[model samples]
Structure formats: structure tokens, C-alpha cells
Target: MERVTGVGGVFFKSKEPAALAAWYRDHLGLELEPGSEAVSVFRWSEPGTTTWSAFPEDTQYLGRAESRAMFNYRVKNLDRMLAQLRADAVFVDDRVEISKFGRFGWAIDPEGNRFELWEPADGL
Candidate 1:
């Protein structure tokens, strides 16, 4: 049998796409994709895997009920990332979850999309 290797990319609709991309670029250090301000390429040099998952219909983990998906970004430091987001006055979830897999934090983008940040545990 064959299996999917990893998530290809995250595509979503934004009302102010260019502004949103710029926000991500300025705040999260994301780079704009070539010839496109509304698209970004989040390239990572480290070795890791992207997870594909689905939540129950009634689950609230993805924020707005109308939202069908959320983007999860892997980072080097959860604390520092969250702190910068907070200092930028972004809407960050008060809760941070720690598990054997890694540490997790969440924040709402300017477009009101809740996104996740993860700092993998050692060897993950």
C-alpha cells in the first residue's frame, strides 16, 4: 500500500489577501512567493513532517465554525513566538498545551483565522 508523505501547502481565502500576506511577512517572517504578494512559501531547512488530521464536526479546536481548516506551523521556540505575537497586539489564545509530542500555541490572524504554532519535542 501507498501513503501520503506530507502536507503540500495550505490554501485559504482571505478578504484582504495582500494585506494579510504582508502581515504574515512582517509579523511571522514569512516570505512572499515570487511575483505574488498574496502567496507565501514557508520553507524550512530542518527535518520534520507535516501532519494531516481531521477533527470531529462539533469540535471547536479550529476556531470559527464556518472554517473548514487551520494551518499549523512548526517553530523553533514557542515562548518567543507567542511573546512576539502578543507584543504585536495580535490576538493570542491564553492557553498553551504541552504533550509528549511538543508544545503548542495559538493565535488569530488579522483575517480572524486561528492558526497554530508548534515546537516539537526533542527528536520529534
Candidate 2:
């Protein structure tokens, strides 16, 4: 019955990860979690936080003034939750996409920040 269960993924723009990964490794004491240099994955734990959403510099999907990250919340039912949000007068994106992974949608918070909503398919 929860609106959101957990985070789905965290993404960031990492061009030339072979060189950039070393910086995160050396400075932040982070190590490669699963992916290789071509694409690095950093798995850390935080309260109600998770995902892999990297936006371009010109983009403002996460928040205004470049907040540096975006979060994708895991919902039980995308259609219902979106309807709830709509009834509550929250701004929900009109488009929804479905894939083998899940059904996805977007919503803007009161703070004018954009975030993602995902209803994972069975066993996903």
C-alpha cells in the first residue's frame, strides 16, 4: 500500500569513465561496484535514496540550478499513483512508457523539481 517502495537507479553523466572513475576512487574513496571503466556503478546506501540518472549539463530534470542528481522512486502501481497525484493537484507528466523492465512516468514536485516514477514488472 506504500506509494513508493525504494529507489530504482541513480544516473550521472560520465564521459570517459576510464579517466573519471579514478577521480571518484582517489578523492571520494569509492571503488568500482559492479560495472567496468566503460560504465562505472557506485552502490551506496542512504535513507529513501537510490538510482542511475545522469542528465546533460543543459538539462534541468532533477532540480533547478543543477542539483547534480535525480532520483527515480519505485511505485507499486504507476497508473493508480499517478491518478492519486493528479487528484491531489500535483503535476504529473502526460506520457508513460512501458518496457520489459517496468512502466515509467514523471512528476514535478512543488519545489519545481522533476523526478521519475517506475512500477517494476514482475520479478524485475
Candidate 3:
């Protein structure tokens, strides 16, 4: 089983999400969907490529983050991947969530950066 396939998303905190998004739009030319408050999805050109967005500074969606950014990695199997991490003595969180989007799990790196593991919903 492939543990991690590719990066699903790159998330970070922003004091002013709209202003930062506008900067990306004007400077980087990232076409952002209008009227999105906290998140703006950037879809990949390749099929099955996952989306990326930024969250508000106070958002708890990424759990406790010592850093301003987090990385979401696309996984083949969240359970197996987490199990492997635990077997290697990695600090894997016990909480796992399943939603319409997909299954999610979290792990802390040696340097204490939090990262997400995602098994995307079917056909996503």
C-alpha cells in the first residue's frame, strides 16, 4: 500500500484572509473564486488532484499548530498509514474523522509540526 501519494493541500493561517487572497490573485495570478470567506479552493489540472486553501488565524480545523502552516498529504489508506507511523514510534494522534469529504488523521513530526493525512472521497 502506498502510504502517501501526493500533497493534497497546503494550509496556513492568515490574519487577513481576503487581503492575502487578493495579493495572491493580483501578484501570483491565482484565480480565486469570489465571495469565499475563509477558504478558496485551487483545483489541480490533473484528474484526482486535490484542492488547497487557507484558513483564518483562529480556525481550529488543523488542530493545535505550533507553526502557521500545515500540509495535507493524500494517502492510500489512513488506517494503515497511521498504523505504520505508530509502529515506527511516531507520535500519531488517536483521533480520526470521517466525513463526506474523506477520512482524516493527524500526526506530529519530530520537530513538532502537525500534518494531516487524507483519504479523499470517491471520485474526488
lDDT by residue (1-124, candidate 1, tens digit) is 2222244335455556677778877998777767776666444455664543434455577789877678877777788888888888999999999998688888999999888888877765
Q: Which regions of candidate 2 are displaced past 4 Å?
A: 13-22, 25-50, 53-67
lDDT value for candidate 2? 0.68
Tens-digit lDDT track of model 3 for 6-82: 88888888889888877887888766766674455656676566555767889777667547888999998899999
What stretches of model 1 exceed 4 Å from their correct place? 1-46
Q: What is the C-alpha local distance difference test score of candidate 1?
A: 0.71
In candidate 1, position 89 carries an lDDT of: 100
Task: Tell me the tens digit of each residue's lDDT in model 2 across 22-83.
Answer: 67668866555565552334344533324333345555555566555567888989999999
The per-residue C-alpha lDDT of model 2 at residue 99 equals 96
Ranking by TM-score: 3, 2, 1
Better of 1 and 2 by TM-score: 2
Give stretches of model 3 more than 4 Å off.
63-65
Which 10 successive residues of model 3 have the least lDDT summed? 37-46
**TM-score comparison, 1 vs 3, better candidate:** 3
